[model samples]
Target: MDSSKELIKTVDLLLEISSLLMVSGANTNRVNLSIDRFASALHCNTSCFISHKTIVMTVYEDNSTLSCTRVKNIPPYAINFSIISAISKASWTAVEEDWNIDQIAKEIEAIKKQKRYPKLVVLIAVSLAGAGFCNIFSGDYINMGVAFASTFIGLLIFQLTHREGYNVYLRIFSASLIASVLASLGIVFKLGANPETALATSILFLVPGVALINSFTDFLDNNIINGLVRYTTGLMTVLAIALGLFIAMLLFQ
Candidate 1:
């Protein structure tokens, strides 16, 4: 069978790629484009229907007698531009070559297995980011120090929840609450010039900025349902953060 015909016969593979692409945070537009790029690369006629949580794809051969359809259920994933970029590169490479289904599958598997930054570096980066935000807000040196410690410890606690992969909202609340307790130590002991800055900036690292930006981008791209859903999720996270801080203040005061 021709390579192009092989692609049509493997509609499930394309759907899998599309689902994985979205799971890496490409947004709806990028996901649609990449899926079309893969289909067109094989010289096949394709139809794709994608929502926030699912992807449905159909590929058809020229004879119209040969076709396949696939449905993929996508789970929520944290934003990771590295994975998204790698997938885009792989799809483009496939477009430029007579790539088979196994080759494409192998490429994805390799990307998934690629090593990430060291955990120590990641933890330090999170701490520095919180301190940086506090400094940007004109926090005093003492406040920045408190923010740094709180963010570092809070992120460590958050990573524990992520490792277990359960109760996402609960994890957020717990992490923020723990961080708030540490941050509010400044106010409790009357140590920092502006302890409120320390408390607020510590959890800044945990904000769902990627989700907020993507949701607005989706709204502008006319993906309203998904846009609203993502925006709502982010909002709930903000509320969780607030609740965590409120409880911390009540006890610490």
Candidate 2:
């Protein structure tokens, strides 16, 4: 194929890689590194700029004489560390094996389609995490049980709302309100020594810890624009959770 065509194809592939990485919770630095690895493996150079909702990429080859630029709108974000890890490994494999574009694309597609844990298992695990937080906050067994139950039901509501295409903040708010309300039942019945602890920790599962961490990482790496975007998003999510808890308090009181 001609140099121009090859550059275009490479750019398209890079856009796909960037999109997947962005949506799968990769930090900006990680995304840039992955793009570099793939470009080097294919004997090309790339300049990729990532923002909150878009990716702009330019690919150059054959001594920078041939080039192409592409802009891709990032899809909705999801948290899938497995995809991030798989793509990180695949980038190295491409370099070591000298894999062509087709091979790399196939590997990425496979990574995209990797099966997640069963829903029931995920629910149980996340609920256990909430319960663990309650215990860490000095809650007794009763508070832990209430937290576990609230977390399970809240996460179920979150999944259902997400599947129905609800807004992200709305989904989180609903989950927080429901979870806090359920936790409050312990207080109403005097069922636990630390019912307030269960109430406080029930919504811990909704914290945007990864986003907040990535925001600081980006700032440290001099990605100021993306850093600000992520920080704002994390802050708004926190507000949404607080609003839900506030309303739950009013209703239960």
- State the C-alpha lDDT per candidate: 0.84, 0.93
Q: Output the worst ten-in-a-row residue range by lDDT, candidate 2.
A: 58-67
Highest lDDT: which candidate? 2
Per-candidate Cα RMSD to the true structure, in Å, reads: 2.2, 1.1
Q: How far off is model 2, as Cα RMSD?
A: 1.1
Model 2 C-alpha lDDT per residue in residues 32-96, reported as the tens digit of each score: 99999999899888887799899999888766666798999998999899999999999999999
Minimum summed lDDT over a 10-residue window in model 1 is located at: 1-10
- Superposed by TM-score, candidate 1 places the C-alpha of residue 213 at a distance from the truth, in angstroms, of 0.9
TM-score of every prediction relative to native: 0.92, 0.97
Give the Cα-based TM-score of candidate 2 against the true structure. 0.97
| Candidate 1 segments whose C-alpha is farther than 4 A from its true place | 1-9
Q: Give per-residue CA lDDT, model 1, range 1-253, as digits (tens).
A: 5754575556877787778777777778888888777777766778888887888888886865777777889887767788889999998899899686778778878988877788789999989899888888888888899999999999998888899986878888988999999998888887667778889898887798878998999999998987897899899999988888889989987
